[model samples]
Target: MSGFKTKKISKNPHQNPMQVSKIPSQKTGFSSKNTPENQKETSENILTSADKNKRRARKISGIFLIISVLVFGAIFAIKAVGNMQLSNNDEYKTFRQITDIFGDNSETPKTPEKRGSKNILIAGIGGRGHPGGELTDSLMLANMNYDTKTVTLLSIPRDLYVAYSSNSAGKINALYPMGQKQNEGVNLLAKKVSEITNQPIHHYLIIDFSGFKSIVDALGGVEVNVPKKIYDREYPNNNWGYEIFSLNAGLQTLDGKTALKFARSRHSTSDFDRSSRQQLLLKAIKDKALSLGILTNPAKISELIDSVRNNLSTDLTVGDLVDIGLAFKDMSNTNILMYSYNNECNGICMPGSYLYTPGRDDFGGAWVLLPENATRSRVSRYENMRQFASLVFEFPHLQNAEKSIRIVTNSKNLSQAKNIRKNLEQLGFPIDHQNAIVQTGATIETTNIHKYYDSAIGTGFDDNHILVEALKKIEPSISQSTGTGAKFATGTGQYIEIILGNDAKNYFQFKGISASMTENNNFSESNKK
Candidate 1:
């Protein structure tokens, strides 16, 4: 396609209550109390012209009210996106003292006695001189709507492809690091997102890792299940991190440090898995803080407020936040909206199918639409923010176990599926599904092994199409199956699955050939075709 198209949804601005009422000010030449009891004697000395003018003035005032009412017709709906409205007066203090994003003296959100669904983006940064490690470990787009007495918390995967909504044409997280210089990263990300989701970001709550830890500690702690041990010998150290979070596969309470690990660890599983863990922790903290009646207890409330104020940065006032928070105090888990970028891209493509890719020339040539998870509507808006939504998928049946993989080009000799498969199996995966398949063209699968493995993790994910670039390097000798590539369902839910696409099963081997990348690292797609 020459250019991507976006879908737009507009909201009408809310009309002012007083505007509709249109009450006009009233004052005549004299007040009724001041009117003379002897009207006949007073009329003899009065200027008839002046009296006539006073009567006309009253008529003009009435006309002014009528004009005000007429002007009310021009009023519009007020739409505030990503604005955080506090549930209680106390919660307001937590926001003001804890956040710094609004600057030393900036206009922060004011409190309105009544509240509505206000959206907020929570960014977890590694602050101080170490902010260089400003990898946003957790990104939450929380929507609190008092109208429905519900809250929706959308957790975005750190690695999902999102347009920085700027000159940066790639991932959304890059907006932060790129922002270090422009000083516009976070805001830019918010703005771009506003353009993308059609929701304006009201306030940004950026927390340093320590502050995050403090908040968790204040909440008593959070609990999570350790899927695998993450040991990064070279992991950053000294307050930053290097220590591995080792835990058996079970539920356990996590202190600040452990909670940090729970949010940041990606060791062996995918970033998708890490996101799930953080979401679980967020819920745990919210539950502990609200259900335990932490706010209701004076001493405990005081301590939490202290901890929260100590760690958070924002532009919201204490009173405004307090009232907003109180409004939301009655809300439960289901009342929340959880928006996932992954879920947005799910089921957008067909499985086992290969789509055209933007060869190196496209960045210099035509805009190519690659097959992957993503909604066309979302892609369009993000594209305006200068980001490509192209996704690559590769899934080949493992054809050989001994050679590990056999080679092949399409009958057209356009791909290298076999070589890559061997590399992946050597990396160690039970990649029999790819090896056993014989077909090469597009197809769909009913029972997917990938979904089975994904569900095993409790994330319950599935994909319809395979990633092409990640696969082409693999050997075609892998068995081909009667399955399509990764296909995630929209709104309902989204997930990446391929029965171990010959490509992903082999990601470890490629990592070596390439270089080691952390959770925040993004693989380069610049080396087109």
Candidate 2:
């Protein structure tokens, strides 16, 4: 197939239209009592316009007032974070004071805030203590939707392969060091991430290991549930040596030091597992901060803010931070969704299933994960991540629906079945290997597609229709029919099962693209492929 042909899916007739109402602005200024009653009436008459301009003017004025209030509130919140009172209305004093508090360099300009959904890239570095301490230890993106009160955290693995300037390539973490050497490390890293994920990062927040530990300590530590026993015998010690880091399975409250270890440990497990632990730890930290009422405690808040000021560096202003803090105050654990691009779940091993592990002769045998498309087409990891980000930010409703459709092929052509599955998954559908529906009956059949539903959930005609429409986009000849046999209705929930036939072999063929990669710090496609 050349391309997945777009189809016109019927809309859900029962979908409700959400209505929003605007608040009418109140008149604040009072008329002078010294004015004559007739003069007041004359003034009111003159103010009134002949047409709808009066209402339009009021709306314009109301919008301006709201913007002014937001700016004022943001500034006030910034001062409050540091336990500083907004005593006088002198703008210059406030500006100078904020500049001093945040250590704003006169040479660096402020980061401009976007009007819509904001994407902030956060980087955690080792910072001045350890060898290559400038290397990023943790990298995550916070995508915040101001109107929806929703947040999605995406973690980018440090070991992923990325191309730098002048055709130099290395691990994703190296971007920071390379950029720092060039005198714009943070901005360069942000630019590279934006290129990789195709999502523009408006601002970046950088904090070293000390700041992370201090912030946790200031918040009195965080609580987490250990899913399994974790014992890392090779955990790094401060003295440039290795030590054991163990945690028993169960609920436990960890101090700053232990929490940092829990997040950074990666001896027994892979980087994928480490990414998961970091996300869980973040959730626990948020929970602990809320439970301790850190926002309400001025002393603790000031200390925490000081920790940030002393150790953290960012282009975002105090007011921007305040605006973010206030906007997402009500966002709880449930409102947060997390995603990571690992070897599994929309990622594939370059030459095999080991993620980014290199061949013996390549890159001095250094391990790296290469990003590939459904057809094994060489593509940038950022391009792949951009699609995932779109699903999180722009297509939440479809993503929720897409996760429900599970494809199971019964045909002998495994290659075609796998290709179809990959295409569907790239489109945001959740297709799991464990959930792959197997064919038990005799294999005499043509290609058939159908939806399976339960009485408890009733008929998912709308969702099923969407699945069928998407399938038709890929294979225009798909026949939508009921499960006339015993095989289709076995699944519990709503799912789409594709019984592949010999016709699939003719439709899908994988052209082996031999990836001729050289043995250097950077990897790229060769013309020989």
lDDT of each: 0.41, 0.55
Model 1: lDDT of residue 367: 27
Q: What TM-score fits each model?
A: 0.45, 0.65
Write the residue-wise lDDT of candidate 1 on 376-425 in tens digits: 22222222111111111011122111221222223322132343343333
Check candidate 2 and list the clashing pairs: 196-382, 197-382, 356-368, 356-369
Which residue segments of model 1 deviate by more than 4 Å? 1-116, 129-131, 160-170, 177-185, 225-236, 239-241, 337-339, 343-529
Model 1 lDDT on a 0 to 1 scale: 0.41
Q: Mind giving the per-residue lDDT tens digits that candidate 2 earns over 251-321?
A: 98888889889888988787777887888887887777768755444445445655655455565653465
The global Cα lDDT (0 to 1) of model 2 is: 0.55
